[model samples]
Target: MESFLETFRNLDTSQKILYVFGGAAVTAVSLVAIRILTLKEEKRKDYPRDKVILHQIGRGPFAPSMTPFAVKLETYLRMARIPYQSQGASFNIFLWTIRRHNKKQTWNQGHGRHTEEEIVEMMNKDIQSLSDFVGRKRFLMGDEPSEADCSVFGMLSQTYWQFYGSGYENLIKDRYPNLASYCERMKDAFWPDWDQCITHGGTREATK
Candidate 1:
């Protein structure tokens, strides 16, 4: 142990980075491998991916077959005894709201049948919904950080914190301070390496 520590400390900067990221990669692989090995043979065959399975389903007339990739990241995290807030059914609503929000439009720009004011109003309605839904909790589902927190933080952080701000940043900050603060708190908690983790290439500067 002493020799290993000495070697690690003596390593060059690049080697140290490789060591850190490599260790993370190794830990992730080990988790998946062990998890798969522990399951029953039939279950193993069914769930090739770690604790998640996808099947084709009929989505009525418009789109006959849809393959929804169900991610059980939270479930897998919990099975491993990892701390995570269950996102519940709120994540689905969040996804739908985001999908409907058009970031390309401005206060005067109109697209399709909806005018700019109508679009902004619609987007604000969703944002306000988020503001109410998030409320005062530190995490999406609760005070404790969970997988749901990780997911929500990823999306919200990009808009508010990512170096190149998103098209809808103002819509949130002007009215949804709670959501903005939530993003900051999550960054402080799980993503101390926020600035360095995902480098932005766009011209826009980072906010807060």
Candidate 2:
């Protein structure tokens, strides 16, 4: 264990990042495999033809979503003009527990490897990269929004809206005004009824 720790500590920052993410990838794939092998297949739901049902994490009274991938997939569906209904709290509890465990393990590994400042610097670098890439462009890839926009916007929404009072909000709102503007454009275009979607966003009906 001592030798292993020493070796890990000796690795460069990029290598450490790669190792952490690679482990996460493996963990995700293993979870999927286990689920396929052990879980009984449910009878498929009958949706109207051409309609899709998205089982995302339940919406909070706060942010659009607590999970980025859920937001990403939903945003992609919207951008593609596909019809879908959002359902939440429908996932297997066992899988959810496993995910939480994996999250802790990943967090521990990352923080153990780097200082808080180092982590923040890395994150800010990523934000800057995104800002540089999207400078003055109406969308990520220029005039029209695409699938890529959905993915980026989903992740950015966390820093912009969800992680309030955490200084990450400033990363978007202050440090990178272009990214902030891009998020606003995406929200304005894709999620016009965003206010109604949240639990306390009034009794107004949320857009499907």
Q: What are the models' TM-scores? A: 0.40, 0.69
| Candidate 1 lDDT (Cα, 0 to 1) | 0.39
- Tens-digit lDDT track for model 2 on 1-208? 2222234345444344433322344235444554464345323545566778675544533346645566678889888899998755422432343344543555565643656467667777888888999999999899999899988887777667655334443657878989889989999988877775654422333343
Over 4 Å off, model 2: 1-46, 90-103, 107-112, 200-208
Q: Residue pairs in steric clash, candidate 1?
A: 84-146, 85-146
Candidate 1 per-residue lDDT over residues 110-194, each given as its tens digit: 3324544554565566667878988988877887776766545534443454212224435457779999788677656654433
Judged by lDDT against the true structure, how good is candidate 2? 0.61
In model 1, where is the ten-residue run with the lowest total lDDT? Answer: 60-69
Give residue 7's error in model 1 in angstroms.
46
